[model samples]
Target: MHAIIQSLCTLWRPSWQGMVMGELKYRRGGGSGGPYKVAASGRRIVRVSASSEAGERMDLLLFPAAGFAGGARAGEAGAPWHRFSADEVRRYSASLGDHNEIHQSERPIVSGFQIAEAMGALEGDRDFRIRFHYPIRSDEMVSLRKEGKAIYGVTDVLCFIWEAL
Candidate 1:
């Protein structure tokens, strides 16, 4: 087996509780296939701990959550690591005129954009909503592993493709 398959099998143990399978019914574009069209969808999960950020809570961690038609990657996606500093948050708030005192305060906590959903700040704007996940703050760390000196975050990214007529 390939290295990727080996690693995945080692890491993920599929249970019989939840499994799905299907079959393709037919092919499109007639039998000759003038222009074959192929579609691909992918999802990736990344795990980052304070250890990866050099033992700093303020450090940032970046990953390629989405890909574009031109194969463009998310900002800082090439880097396996990033640092989330107060200075960066402050700068972003300043640039965007988000002068909320909570963002400017020197508190040990930052808000999660998901909280906005509970607070009714999120609307139909998905982009803005996701950006909230990045810039917003929380009163307490929402990361898992609340005990000891470690935290973990899990983010989901959705990407798609479209052809113009």
Candidate 2:
């Protein structure tokens, strides 16, 4: 297993009740084929592996519940993690002229794009994808943490995952 995959497993170990596996493979057009389903036994977990034959690889994980039961990762306990506030998210949205209710709501949900812009800058502009498991509400303070190349925002449960594409 690659170190990044290993690190990701460790990050998900606490809340996601499933396994993580990746088989690095390539496609016909000279690209790494991946993310294809590898067959799953239950909804608690779904397998994603590289397809030997394919077009685009679609790697993913489906857990029993949102963020595997909807809560903060146990690894975030103690010593205070970085936080993102509703004010910060809202302010960012205003600056971007994105007045969409999702980011403009009184108890707004943070803009996934803002989180991507702020947290994934290291990965470069428009170079990453963010998967939001649960909404990151602006009214509540949530902890933000970076693990490997992935950025996570969580309040009581895992909210979003910002990572390299």
Candidate 3:
């Protein structure tokens, strides 16, 4: 089975409203390609997971920055991946109404992306969903042990939907 990878939650805040965006990257053995662009809406559900500490809920691992590092592995396609920093995680948590101490306290936090579904529907009447398969993340360092024909390939095109009233 192939593994699913997700990128960090990037936010663009120019004014009162904040926009959230993420990237998906991946590569198989013996390939020379590039990262592809992905479009997402409120209905999309991305599977995500990360390392957890004591008293932490396993569900928290479902966040975008919850899985393996996203980027180009050796002998694979695309560029390297950059892990998300605690500061970035904190910022996302604040913007998303997540005040977890694990993300707020002065401690080392894990970074990366995982697969997960959108927790809620879109806030407005506009709804959309996007699915992309490939190198699920972008970074400088990647695990060579996990790159193989059967281990690295698109397994499914996850579909997410949302309805606003």
Candidate 2: where is the Cα deviation over 4 Å?
Answer: 1-82, 122-126, 145-149
Q: Which pairs of residues clash in candidate 1, taking residues 3 or more apart in a chain or in different chains?
A: 59-83, 59-84, 60-82, 60-83, 60-84, 110-137, 110-138, 111-137, 111-138
Please provide, for model 3 over 1-165, each residue's C-alpha lDDT reduced to its tens digit, 9 standing for 90 to 100.
011122123321122121112332222223221232223233233333221122111111122332223433224323222344556556545654433344454542322122222211112212122222222222213221223222221212111111121
Which numbered prediction scores highest in TM-score against the true structure? Answer: 2
lDDT order of candidates, top first? 2, 3, 1
- Residue 95 lDDT in candidate 1: 44
Please report the candidate that would top lDDT against the real structure. 2
The lDDT of model 3 is 0.27
Comparing 2 and 3 on lDDT, the stronger one: 2
The lDDT per prediction is: 0.24, 0.47, 0.27
RMSD of 2: 11.5
lDDT for 58 (candidate 3): 13
The TM-score values for the models, in the order shown, are 0.22, 0.44, 0.25
- The Cα error of candidate 1 at residue 129, in Å, is 6.3
